[model samples]
Target: MNILELAEQNFLITFSVVIGIGLLQGAIMGRGIRSRFPSLKRHARSASIVLLALFSINAIASVLKFAEPVKISVSELTIPETIEEIFTLIVNVMGINAGVGAAIAIFVSVTLIIFLKFANIHQIARYFIFVISCAVLIVVLLGKFTDFVPTAFQIMLYAFYQFGITVGIFLVTKRKETDVLSGIK
Candidate 1:
């Protein structure tokens, strides 16, 4: 109805689109992995790294822009102060910060995995490392969701930015044969 309301509406729709796209991407990627099965299994570590790298890039972006202004612009439309601030915080914090942290977690876990294998460590350490990775991944997702936007659309947009970090790195790093490429032979 009004200018601010309109801006909020647009913001909602934009993010919703992102989430929808994310679901679609996940489905397609999942199918690809499934079809490849055992062959794709070999690529797991690299794939995890890709997710981490993308998330980390986003986190870096978030850290860099944490104190920046609200960035809302569409065609000739502009957002009001209150709405802009909310979205701004969401992007800089939840979208970026959380993502970067997740990436680093992935890297650390992957490294440990490689070292243990190389040194001929037992199953105990490997299991612990796997648990740690799961913990990091869960924490990141929880933290991201906790920084909720006001509406359904906001959630979608934020999800888009959040998942963008995960998906981007995944696509980029996935070319490698191993997830933990650096430590291996």
Candidate 2:
């Protein structure tokens, strides 16, 4: 069978795997955040619930958007011959409007900045992440409103979004071990 057919047949499994990975990533990031900012340890359960709810909404919206058939015109079906062309094709398929794309870019930029500020990582690594995230935002904004930026940079922006969301999900989900032991006792 064709790849599309296989994907259609295993949609449920694919969705589950994606969500499972997101959850795992979120949990790890949350623990890291809590370790870095001990003030958040007191609100782990509530934070987890809020994050889970947000994730559920996002997943539902994604499923709803993709479950329907999409129509592609003949001109749009041309195969991309180069890496740059492939990236452009992917960006076009995402179909984000300029205004929405700009808003998302801004939001992602702010989120990444906040995450990097509080992330439990080495200073050098934090600086690298901060610089890369800002660069990705700039590239995404230019790509959205102008033609000078390469669409391949949009992939980096999306990756930042994924990381931000995962970290947000687990931001306060890690309580101190003593708290857990006290509850058990």
Candidate 3:
């Protein structure tokens, strides 16, 4: 298949996987894992609901190619006729086409994690997210410098960046659930 076909297939697969996981997690939240603790279960239920929303939003963004974060410096801002075309041309010229969307999404998710932490929504999970996000963000920002970054490292960074968000969500949800149950708040 051609590149466009491959991209379409990838978008479909990613949308499917993200939606399926969200559904599965939602189902699991109702499985009565610890029915004895009502408050803990409530907390878990809330967290799982938020997780579902996040997964859904991210999936839509990914499928629609809205995950990309375009840098808009005040000095470089312009009123272009075709914004998408302009952005595409710029990104193509810059040669950082691969995984730019995912990197931006990771950064956004990391920001949300930090916000959630500061708001005292999920303390335990926030700490884990802070650490993981730091790692992913570092790789993403550093990836802009191809001369300094090796090809193998870029490939690995891409992989890690994609997987890191999923793992972060899972870990945060798990920790939130368990911490609530164990009276850790």
Candidate 4:
């Protein structure tokens, strides 16, 4: 495949990887939060599920955008126009030049993560994940790096950012668990 095709495939794989990480993180973090705060069970569970769904949707959008496998257009998609536009801008600016639908997927997922962070969900790890991911996404969306770096490097940076989220979850989970067992009283 040509370099552009390779880039598209790399992005699709990246989105899929993020979805997997998001699901695992959500499940572990959600379970931990509910166990720590029984009163917030409903809110915690719902938020985690939505976070997973957002990532999954983005993965699907990326898949549909691949012309070699299939052709999915923004006009024919069911995702909201605002979401489509945001994704279009990100993918175009980042050099993907396809899959407005995929862009919508990642954008919404990141947006939801930010929203959860400010909603006071009681999980420090959640906030860390949002902050890190948002910083990366915002920089890419701004298209500031287009001229400075190759597209492959940008995609690799994103993959590394997602990996960092997993590490944050582990650190936060461990610290929170320790705090519970310390018996400060």
Candidate 5:
């Protein structure tokens, strides 16, 4: 296995997961909308359907393009030409010891958002994302003297995770479909 291969795999895996996510989102949103205000379901259905289509096409194309080997603005940064090598490069750059754990963590977070129903969920989840962002910021701050990690990269990834999580939640739970909204109708 090499970095290029690993990167390619990541790209494919990412696209596949996003598609799976789209299906999950549709189911959850449908449940939420129908259970809450059945009247709105008819209109909301179309919007959610369109969202799924657009999301699938965009996610797949973006990942495939991103999987291509690329150079970085930072010093001595060249992405591995193979997927396996890409994993090594990622591990080396992030100082991440585990190879598959990052993907697992993302999946776990998504699962948590899906199965758990904490109070003020959207705000709570946003706060959770904020905490994640802060943790990344702290790591970057601590790594200051080291030449390896870039602060900019850390910031970017943090923002990416935050938005990604938010979107994931949106895909999984639609505003019209929530149990909380049921009483209002």
Candidate 6:
């Protein structure tokens, strides 16, 4: 196959990978939160459900966009205008659904973090907030600076951010040594 064909194959693979990893990460985070904060277990479950629904919708939109890519008319556009148009097109193609999903995810994550902070889990909340902030910052930077990056690569990067969140939550909710030892006995 030619390079274009190879890239297309890779793109589909990457999309699938992102979806799988995202689902797994969501499950992990939900379980961790529920275990760590029994009072907030329902909140964790609701967040996970909402996130999953949003992500699933976004994934479907992305696959549809990939299958039938959108075409634009740039003949009358100047350089700057063309750039803007292209950026808009890219955003549309790369799941405006995803943008909405990310926004909701961020809101839910921040709310959870706030609850954690108020509950006196200061250090864990700080780390989780930091990870979420970094993920958002990196995504914004990528959107601004990497116009040349492929859609598949951008999706993969999003998956990486989800993984980071999972890791942060894992650290936050892991059983203490004393708890582990007591359970062992």
Candidates in order, TM-scores: namely 0.27, 0.39, 0.35, 0.35, 0.30, 0.37
lDDT of each model, Cα atoms only? 0.46, 0.48, 0.44, 0.47, 0.43, 0.47
Per-residue CA lDDT of model 5 for 46-114, tens digit only, reads 655554444444333323222321222345667579999888777555433423443444344344445
Per-residue lDDT of candidate 1, residues 1-185 (tens digit): 97536757687666565545544333333333323343544675666575465455544443333323233333424454698676865555434344545456445445434534554323543454456436535544544444422344433344464475356335534543533322222
- Which window of ten consecutive residues has the lowest lDDT sum in model 5? 62-71
Residue lDDT tens for model 2, 1-185? 97545645786664454445445445444544555656666766676666555554443433222222133344556888999988877655554322443344445445535764676645544554456446544543444444343322223324434544554455436453423212211
Q: In lDDT terms, how accurate is model 3?
A: 0.44
lDDT of 3 at 76: 53
Per-residue alpha-carbon lDDT of candidate 4 for residues 48-76, written as tens digits (9 for 90 to 100): 45544554455455333321222233455
Which model is ahead, 1 or 6, in terms of TM-score?
Answer: 6
lDDT of 3 by residue, 29-125 (tens): 2222333233544576575556545654554444333223333343554655798978965665343464744555555556554545344333443
In model 3, which regions exceed 4 Å deviation? 1-114, 121-132, 146-154, 161-165, 171-185
Model 3 TM-score (2 dp): 0.35
- The 10 consecutive residues of candidate 4 with the worst lDDT sum are 176-185
Query: Clash pairs of candidate 2?
Result: 30-170
Higher-TM-score candidate among 2 and 4?
A: 2
Model 1 lDDT at residue 59 = 46
lDDT of 6 at 45: 44
Q: Poorest 10 consecutive residues of model 1 by lDDT?
A: 64-73
